[model samples]
Target: MTTTSTYDVHTVRAAFPILQRTVHGGKPLVYLDHAATAQKPQAVLDAIGHYYRTTNSNVHRGAHALSAEATAAFEDARAVIAGYVGAARNEEIVFTSGTTDGLNLLAATVLTSAQPGDEILLTEMEHHANIVPWQMVAQQRGLAIRVVPVRDDGTISVDDVASLLTERTKVFACAHVSNVLGTINPIAEWSALCQANGTRCIVDGAQAIQHCSVDVQALGCDAYVFSAHKLFGPTGFGVLWARYDFLDALPPYRGGGAMIDRVTFSGTTFNAIPMRFEAGTPHIEGAIGTAAAIRWLQEIDTTERIAHEDDLLRHTTAAMTAMDGLTILGTASHKVGIISFVVDGIHASDIGTLLDNMGIAIRAGHHCTQPLHQRFGIDASARASFALTSTREEADMFVEGLAKAIRMLR
Candidate 1:
């Protein structure tokens, strides 16, 4: 961790125009629901607008100059994203609609290799995006599904995962970070374990990508998936990075325009690695915007921004812990900036509603991890998640607003 000497929260917040807006009753908005989708900065918005104004053309099809320019920009975005995630090569990166789309794509193609009685292993803390796809695939493939249970503190142990893995386990899908609990799972060790057990390891990195630097090669997972919206980029765009060999070996998820090569009425052959996975006209502007967002974040002092977020987490956590009848859901030793809590005898919805009335945005629900919520013996929780641009003042406001909300509810 480094000191926040060069990073200024106010300066960073100014880059996001949404931060300056007023919500309910003329109150200033204190946006804290970053885990849902981060607010985009002006740099990303400018990039998208510039692309539409100057270079709006389909890629890889036309022989004209505009098409050539669009093609170069799109591929350059891929290279930038690949480097940001520490992928071994650019060809391994496949653009998808979002994380859910990527996971479903992998589930459909990867599970085709499993036989009856083959197992698909997952952790109890996975988001529905990670769980439902594997379940759908297992049902189709005659494969069994197994889950590694989370401990009381909302953390999963490597040993628990090892105990569950067997020769029959064909795939291990887990999250790099828990969206609700903020627990950072041990991905590297688990990936190594999956390799030793001859199981393919897939990581859901939707929640982790914005907060931490990801190295798919270092983690040694067969595939990693995340959405661009969570990283202050546009929604409806994401990246799925797999080992080039693994991706080349799997069948294509969907077949259509760009994914084909030498198509004819008699027979058709598919294109190479990434294009084979990306079937339609790609999100050309979305790619440009995502690359711009990644570049904008890189311009900041990473260590200082990380320290600032950590301070927000510590301050908010300490304040919430001191409140009566308030219980934080997850107490994992390591976590990102997300914090979920429940108030005694008060519905989580009520807390969120009152917070919204006070012009504070927070999320209240199972957060797409109903199973994890069930494990915690609750149906829903109030979650306040932070981003790199979030301020200590906003965290203080949340703590203060939450206290008032609890009082009024009580």
Candidate 2:
């Protein structure tokens, strides 16, 4: 067991004012919806505000001083984000609206290279954002989409994936951690398997980036995608890190002012690897906020933060296990700070509503992974996810709230 210092949690929570706010008729807010989107700290908020106030100008077009300053700040944010993800160069990092946009870009670009018989491999536990785009591309390109089945425990089997791969497999897209099941996939081993089988691996890191350390190069993945909102940053911003050679080979997803080299009436040459993908003006302030969010996380000892969340998870798990009619989902040995479960004789939405009345925010429904819910023979689940600022008291309150809701419903 990792021993955590109490002061770290206290100090970290203090930086997030939303965690201290009261809601729902003056009740204290117990936010357990970090998986969907994390609340930004003061630092991130200030960074966004500062950028808009002081350096509010369009990038890469104007020759004015403000344009230069804004361009520098935006590129600086890109560099910071690249460093945080352990990418070798900032040119390899492409900013998108969110993870969905990043995945869509990859699907669209890679589809151009795929032929009628080419196969794109995916896992059963993928989010709709990761699944739907590829399906659309496959339909248009006459490509085959193969799904790797998950075990009864909700974790994907590498052997099943190995069996599905062949010489025709062109792309292997999967999630690092399932948003619904909280199962952390074996990404490194899976990437190696894909490499051995001549498949390009794309990892959806939306759920994994907030809880664990992510190093794109170290993971040996062809591409990695994650959203900033899930990591205590602003929405409308995400990252896609790809190998330079692969990114260079792929055609541009979009073409516009910033992504062009020479625009003639007959033809137009595209820009470099990242700029080729970034077609228009991006979310400038969002990028600044994301950089600030990463800096804030870097300041904290990640080991301690992980340990704190694990303690809360353990306590919550024990309480859920003690309940007579409750069945917890996703029993992967390695998971992050998320718990999804169903109470007997009650719908997940009812539990979510009851908890909301008590100023506790949780998520209920398929969680953007309807196929996963169907696989488990469940319509939905109530999820309570934690973060660095979550505490044991909040976990206890969640359990109590659930108990109250169960009894009332019964």
Candidate 3:
């Protein structure tokens, strides 16, 4: 991958109005926290606002013109999203609240397929969403949850995954990119291993979607999951994409209005595929905003933009690494634009507080991956994540502020 790109960061930054605001005492806001959630772009906000202003109506089963317009926009969003993820069919995309909800739905589906002694293999670097859902499922069903070890560099090796695979391994759950480490995982190879052993491969793409090019079919996983907000869209939206066979076989997660085809006192028939999984009145504006975001993404050169992000990350990493007493947590060779670190003799919360005063935004604490932090022998780390809208100046400011914060704490 090229270190430099012609991708215009300033132009992209202008699209996000949040970049214009000053956070603390009139200092320019340097948002280095995209991993937690991204700031919405004007195009996305406009699309959502336009929908509410012009086409605010319940979708499907409506004779009104507004409902017809809303339904078209909504279903079109599904097709747009499905195409973005390289799904074979739009019906494969089932909307959820976010990646957490998607995991819970997958957890529920996999539960029905697993027996008491069956095993679910999870990587040690997984976020709590991927971990807790399976933990709950294992407790409910008579199944076991096995952990795949993460290396010192915040990556799970192929050998580690291979050693964990067994006949009873029903589901091999993994992340496309480490949310904490930012390491790009070898999902295709891992999925191939799962397929060889008759295990279901489910990949969490919550972190990967915005950073790299992702093709669900190319990854060769049985299922893929991600949230829209991470992709520069609205909150309260996520997507779960599974094979047609799995969607047909997996039971509904909830019983509700849109998900049921027929309901009788004795029995009930559920809706088909995507609708079956999407039980209630879905988030109409969320879908519209997500589709808008995808369209905006398509309009730009994504490959170039990703290269630009990498450039910013490499620069930031070098600058942060050179600082005295500041140790970056995840040093994996392959990663997105994430820098998680802890300053010696300084609590992470204190660093965060100091950075906030300087108009710098960085995340502190376990970052929702407590196990990963425990593995590193620390309770928390300060994280500064980057997105396409992020600029080199912001990275410089963050480093300068962090150094000052460390001196203050000492």
Question: TM-score of the candidate numbered 3?
Answer: 0.98
Predicted candidate 3 versus true structure: per-residue lDDT over 1-410, tens digit per residue: 24356778889889999889997679999999999998898999999999999999998779999999999999999999999999999999999999999999999876796779899999989999999999999999979999998888888889989999999999999999988889999999999999999999999999999888989989999999999999999999999999889778898898998999999999999999899988878999999999999998888898788888888899999998889888887788889998899888899999999999999999999999999998989999999999999888888999889989988989
TM-score of 1: 0.98
lDDT of each: 0.93, 0.91, 0.91
User: Tens-digit lDDT track for model 2 on 186-290?
Assistant: 899889999999899999999999999998877999999999999899999999999989888889887787889899999999998788988889888888899
Model 3 ranges with Cα > 4 A deviation? 1-4
lDDT (10s digit) by residue, model 1, range 1-410 = 23527777888889999999999879999999999999999999999999999889999999998999999999999999999999889999999988999999999999786889999999999999999999998888889999999998889988999999999999999999999989988899999999999999999999998998788888989999999999999999999999999999999789899998889999899999999999889999989999999999999977787778888888899999999999997789788899999999999999999999999999999999999999989999999999998888899999999999999999
Q: Report the Cα lDDT for candidate 3.
A: 0.91
Which candidate order results from sorting by lDDT in descending order?
Answer: 1, 3, 2
* Best lDDT among the predictions, by candidate number: 1
- Per-residue error for 118 in candidate 3, Å, reads 0.7
